[model samples]
Every structure is written in C-alpha cells, then in structure tokens.
Target: MQRVVEEISLKAWPAFETINHRGWLMRFANGYTKRANSVTVLDEIGLDIEEKITYCESQYRARKQNPIFCLLSFTNPEVLDERLATRGYQLIEPSLVMGITLSERSLNILPIINQETLNDWLVAYHKLKALAEQPSSTHHMILAGIQSEILFVSFKQNEEIVACGIGVLESGCLGIFDLVTSPMQRRRGYATAIIQGLLQWGIDKGAYFSYIQVVKANIPACNLYEKLGYEPIYEYWYRVGSNSGNEK
Candidate 1:
C-alpha cells in the first residue's frame, strides 16, 4: 500500500524532466516542489549508499542546487536511511500524504478559468503561506505543465475570489494541490466547496481514489481532510544539510 501511494504521488507531480542515477530518480522542475527537485529512491540500488549519496550530491551541484536531498519514506531502503543519518542529514518539512477513495459528488466541468482566476488563486496561496507576491514564470510553468486533466476551482464572495484549489486526474485517481482560502474568509464553507467541486470532476472521470499532501503541523487541514475520509498512509521528512537534503 505504501509503494502504491508513493507511485501515485510521483505520477501526480511528475518532473518536467528526469535523470536516473544508480536506481535513484533525480527529478528536476526548476525547483517548483521539492518532490520535483529532490531525489527519490524507491528501489534498492547496487552502489554503496555513501557512494550513491556522493554521486547525487555532485549531480545536484552540477545543476546549481545545494544541500542535496532525498524523499524518504518507510518504503525506502533502511540501509540508505542509516547512511544518511551517519552522515548528519537532518530531517525537515515532515508531511503527511493522505488519500481517500472517491465517491459521488456535485460538480460542473468548470470552464477553463481565466488568468484572473489563476491570479486570485496565487494571491490567496501566497498570503496564506506568507510568501512574497507570487512569481508567474516558475509557478505558472509548474502548474500549466501538468499532463493530467486539471481544473482551477475557486469560491467567490461578492465577486472576489476567496478560496481556490488545483484538481488533477490521473490513472483512476485525483490529486488535490494548492487548496487555499483567503485567511479572512476561512471558517466559512468556501474551502469545502472547492474540494467538492474537484472531487465531482474526479468522480465523473470514474476515479476510485483521491490524495492530498499537507504539512504535518497544519491542524485545520488535517481535521478537514479527516472529516472527508482521507487518512495518512505514510509520513516522510526531509533530511537536510550541506551534506544532504530532506524529503521534498
């Protein structure tokens, strides 16, 4: 089950390009999400773990990224984990990968939204996340490059956008990303409405399951997702250092 969920995650946020290094997959997407930029090793490899780490570090350096990192889950090889620990890799950004089996729901195909809607979504995300004004180039490239069917759904109050989400449908599953609500408008049903809209699209496509990634410390999101039937299948934390990197 863990392996299956990890595979779904990889498919959901595939890198724009990838490199295979000694059984480890190095995904690069202009540093959009750590998942796309970090190393993922799901299978056992032939090289010594320390040597493999050295190789990955050199590769990321070539790409001008520091603090080489890896996506580590329980399904990853134990020997690799020990090697990273021995080398002083510290974990950060622990996150829960939650999933649910989709059921029927209400939805409209939601016409391909205009750029304004996309703008609103980014604003909400940046505000909630305390990021600077959203940069259109990197973020837009990441969002628009997804090959799976997707929709940008939002909730409006008095003609202003208050909540938004990105729904992706791939291989019988829907992966929800960037679900955000204006801080002032939260505690209303706006977030839930956006989720329902995305799920409905997935149900229409005959998807059997859905998944979302939330920071482990986010209590409100965990509560909401729990209410919606999503459960944490696995927990992963990034091991970060100048010598190594943590989960992305």
Candidate 2:
C-alpha cells in the first residue's frame, strides 16, 4: 500500500525535474514545495547509502537547495532517517497518507465548478491560498507537469469563489491536493462542499479510491477528513538539512 500510494502521489503531484539516483527519486521544482524538491526512496536496490546521500546533497546544493530526504517507513532504509538526524537534518511535517474507498453513493453528490483553463484555476488557487508571486509561479509549473486526468474544482458563494481543490485521477485512484478555503469563509461548509464535489466528479470518471496527504498537526483538517471517512494508511515526513533556507 505504501508503494502504491507513493506511486499515485508522484503522478498526482509531479515535479518539474526528476533524477533517479539508483533507487532514490530526486525531485526538483525550484524549491517551491518540499514534496517536489526532496529525495524520495523508491526502491531498496541501491547500496552505499552514504554515497547516495552525498551525491543527492551535491545535486541539490548545485541548485542552491539544501537536500531534503522524504522518508516512508517501508520504502526507505531503516537507518537512513537516524543517520540524517545525526548529520543535523531536522525532522519536520510528520504527515499521514489517508485514503477512502469510493462507492456508487459518491456519484450522487453534486459537482462544483470545474475550471477548464489552467490559468483560471491558478488564479483561484493563488487567491484562496494567498500564495506569493514566486512560489505561485513555481506552483504553476508543478501543476502543469501533471500528466494524468486532473480536476480543478472551485466552490463559490454568491458567484465568488470561496474554496478550491484539485483532484488527480490515475489508475482508478483519485489523489486530492491543495484543498483551500477563504479565511473569511471558514466554518461555512465550503471546504466540505469542495471535497464532495471532487469525489463526485472522480467517481463519475471511474475512480474507486481517493487519497489525501495532510499534516498531523492540522487538527481541523484531520478531523474533517475523518468525518469524511478518510483513514491513515501510511505516514511520511521530511528530513531537512540545516541549510534548507526555505524549508516547508
């Protein structure tokens, strides 16, 4: 299940550039998001863990980025996480990979506005998330890199977009990302509406499973996802080197 979800996520939120160093997937996206700019252990075939770490660090340093290692318990070397910590890598953003099985009932939910234009979706996403210009530009590049079927959904109140989310469908699975709601519109069920809408659309398109990645510290979001029947299937966290200036 770890490998399956990780594979789905790699496609659901792709990086602008990916370099496979033996068994590690070194993803880069101009340091926009850690998920897109970290070393992810995808296989156990590679030997010489220290050598691979040195190589990945050099690669990230060449681009002026501090190397970040994203570790999944079952996929990474058992000692890698500890080794990173001893070398001054900070553990951050302990998150859960949650999923729910979709059924015919999800199809009955009403759909929301499906923004067809990538620019339009980007505009809405930036506004809803209040992202700055530089990161927003990098976000655009990352979203543009997605190769699977994607749904850019927006929820509006009185014709004003109050919430937005993205659903990427691949191999019968729907991966949800960047679910955001306007600050002034909190507790109004806008986010809930967006999730339901995305699930509806995904199920209509033949998706039988849906997953989301959320930080453990986000109590509200974790509770909401729990209410929606999403359960934690696995966990992953980023090990950040001391020099990671813009770590997320």
Candidate 3:
C-alpha cells in the first residue's frame, strides 16, 4: 500500500506543481526544476550523497524567505534525513494523498455564500487556520487567485462560519484544496456539506474530475474522505533540514 501510494504521489507531481503558490523549485547543475511543495525527492547524479545534501540545504535556506518549508515524501530517504538531522532540521508529520472521481459520485449541496457574506467566509478560514501546522497566508493567497476562476462555497450555522471549500477548474478537472471545518464544527455533517457544495460548483463549471490530499495518520479525516467516496491516491512524507554544514 505504501509503495502504491508513493507511485500515485509521483504521478500527481505535475498537478501539484501547477497548483503550488510558492513557486518552489529544485536547483540542478544544468538548470532548475519546479519543486513539489508538499512532497519531492532529491535526485542528484555525479555528486556524492553529501554534496546532494549540501545543495538541498542551500536551496532550502534560500527558500525559507517564504516562511515555513515543506519536504514531503512517502518513504524515508535515510541519507537525506540523517544529513538534515545533523543540521537543525526536524522531521514533521506525514501527509496522505486522497482522491476521488467526480463522475463516480453525485453532488447535491447548495451554496450559501454571496458578496454580502464575504466576512463570514474570512472568519471561517481564520478559525480553521488555527488547526494547521503553519499560518494560512499561502492558502489565503491561493483562494484569492481562484476567486475569479472558481466558486468559494461555504456553510454557516447560527450565523457563524463553520465549513468552507474551494474548487478550481483545470484541464477538465476540479482540484479541491483547503477543505476545512472548525474543531467545534466537526461531527455535524458540515464537512460533507462543504465538499458537496464545492462539487456542485465544479459540475456547474464543467469539471469532469476532482481530487484532494490529506495526512496518512489522520485516520478520522481519512475515514471521512472515504465515506464521501474519496479513495487513497497516494501518500507523502515531510522531511525538514537546515544548512549548517556538510557538503556533498
């Protein structure tokens, strides 16, 4: 299952690159390749492992200007992990890549948002932001960009924002990101409603497919996604490292 997940993750690299907001990239001797924000691998030939580590650390330090850094994978690259540990970096949590076919499921949630309810949407996002490892700036920026191209459907209870989701139209598919519900709002079907609302929006936009990513260890979330017809598409691991010493 792990290997299968890894392969699927590798397959989604292109889509991941297209949706990434940070514009992260990997520098090579010949040129630079766009880096996968949530997951990627270090593949450097000619240079020994140490040299590769040095290069990646340098790149990571340079990219830290954007705030938090993410190194995602499905398996442990011991060589890289050890090098990173020698520095000040620490391994964070693992993430899962879950996906579903739009045609396989039906969407029937009504969107309850309009220009007058924009503040409610922002409040909901802020509430969910507290649950993420990092702040929500990147997500906020992405949402801002997609507003013109996609529908931002949300759900509220008692006039309080509880759940929100976004659907982006790309290459005949709807890529769903930042589907979140507040801790206080769980177990009340708000998440399901939010996803359904987004799916309905996607269908309206002529999208034929949909997909999302979640952490592997988050069993409750995995169950929720599976219950909603999402299947395991891939898995990714996050490794952190710093540039303090050791050249390849």
lDDT of 2 by residue, 46-119 (tens): 56877888889889988998899998866655688877877778899999999999995655657465564678
lDDT digits (tens) for residues 212-235 of candidate 3: 777777788889888988887544
Clashing pairs in 1: 68-245, 69-245, 238-246, 238-247, 239-245, 239-246
Q: Alpha carbon lDDT of residue 184, candidate 2?
A: 87
TM-score for candidate 3, residues paired by index: 0.66
Error of 3 at 42 (Å): 9.6
TM-score of 1: 0.84
- Model 2 clash number: 0
lDDT of 1 by residue, 1-248 (tens): 66676777777677777778777787777767777778788665446767778877777767776544666566555666667767777767888989988666544445332223556566656665656765556776777677778777767777776777888888888889888888778888777777777777789888888889888999999999998788987777665556234422
Global CA lDDT of candidate 1, please?
0.73
Q: Which candidate is the best by lDDT?
A: 2
